[model samples]
Target: MATLDESERYRILSDERRRLVLEILAERTTGIGLDDLAQAVTTRQTTGTDVGPGTVDRVRIALHHKHLPMLDESGVLSYESEVRQVEQPRVASERHA
Candidate 1:
């Protein structure tokens, strides 16, 4: 399991979109599909703003290339690249306790 330090945890939560990912994951009892997750994140990020087309794909790519890896490395989430699925790790919940 990935270890967590104060700096790392803070880093994981630092970005608004990344924080949104965590929030969405926490609500899901099952792993969330990448497309669904991207849609949810885009919805939150572009709620009152004029979002351009391909925003969801951009979010998906960013999550795949950056944010998800950060969360996985921080022990917060288990990201299955092959399936493009994400689930909150057990240690992540324990860390919150």
Candidate 2:
């Protein structure tokens, strides 16, 4: 596992989207499909607003190309790009515990 200093941890959690991703992952025991995760995030982001498919698509793309990979690299979560799955690592889970 990669060790994250305080600054690195703060940097990773600084983004609202990344924080949301971790929150969603915390509720699940298994990996989530990228599409499902993206939808969930979009729903949360635009709770009372009417979000279109395009908005969801944008969030999906961001997660796939940016957020997921960053979190994966930081050892905060396990993101399988090819399979498009996201799950919190045991270390991350334990931190929540």
Candidate 3:
């Protein structure tokens, strides 16, 4: 596995959705959910071109297969569940259910 540094981080941050991911993560002190991450990226105004909120296929699947694992592997983020995301909010919901 490759080690991550500021340069790699910046490289990852350059992509639109990936940049959004970094922005969202930077906004929070703790980790956010995978779905929340996708939602945060895609959600937009009524008239705007929403790139995601799209087939739900790209964001959801890419998030699971690529983004999440990349973040975790790069030591940028951490979580338990891959299928549903394991943020504090989701964990609470899981507990209450």
Candidate 4:
């Protein structure tokens, strides 16, 4: 796997959704459910907008199709596709510590 430098980490973290995901992951000791993560993202994203099940669904889709994979590939998080669990990588957790 390729190493992510500071700039790349910043780029990956630039998206609000991705940043939220990382923040949520960082707070949890165990893997978080994807649905719970999506809800948390939706809660933050819907502050001044029309929020609905559709909004949650859209976030879920984006997380599954785009964000999660990118995070997994970047060594930021370990995404268990079958179980839909998101966990922080040891290196990432160490950095946070």
Judging by lDDT against the true structure, name the best candidate.
Answer: 2
Per-prediction CA RMSD (Å): 4.3, 4.2, 7.2, 4.3
The TM-score that candidate 1 achieves is 0.83
- Count clashing residue pairs per candidate: 0, 0, 0, 0
Ranking by lDDT: 2, 4, 1, 3
What are the runs in model 4 whose C-alpha is more than 4 Å off? 1-3, 48-50, 91-97
User: Clash pairs of candidate 3?
Assistant: none
What's the CA error at residue 87 for candidate 3, in Å? 6.2
The CA lDDT at 62 in model 4 is 97
Error of 3 at 50 (Å): 5.2
> Where does candidate 1 stray beyond 4 Å?
1-3, 50-53, 91-97
Clashing pairs in 2: none
Query: What does the lDDT come to for candidate 1?
Result: 0.85
Question: Please, what are the lDDT tens digits per residue for candidate 3 over residues 1-97?
Answer: 2356889877676667666666676678776666777677665222275454464556766767776666666655554553565332233355578
* Model 2 vs. true fold: TM: 0.88
TM per model? 0.83, 0.88, 0.60, 0.82
Structure candidate 4, residue pairs in collision:
none
Which structure among the candidates has the greatest TM-score? 2
The CA lDDT of each predicted structure is 0.85, 0.92, 0.60, 0.86
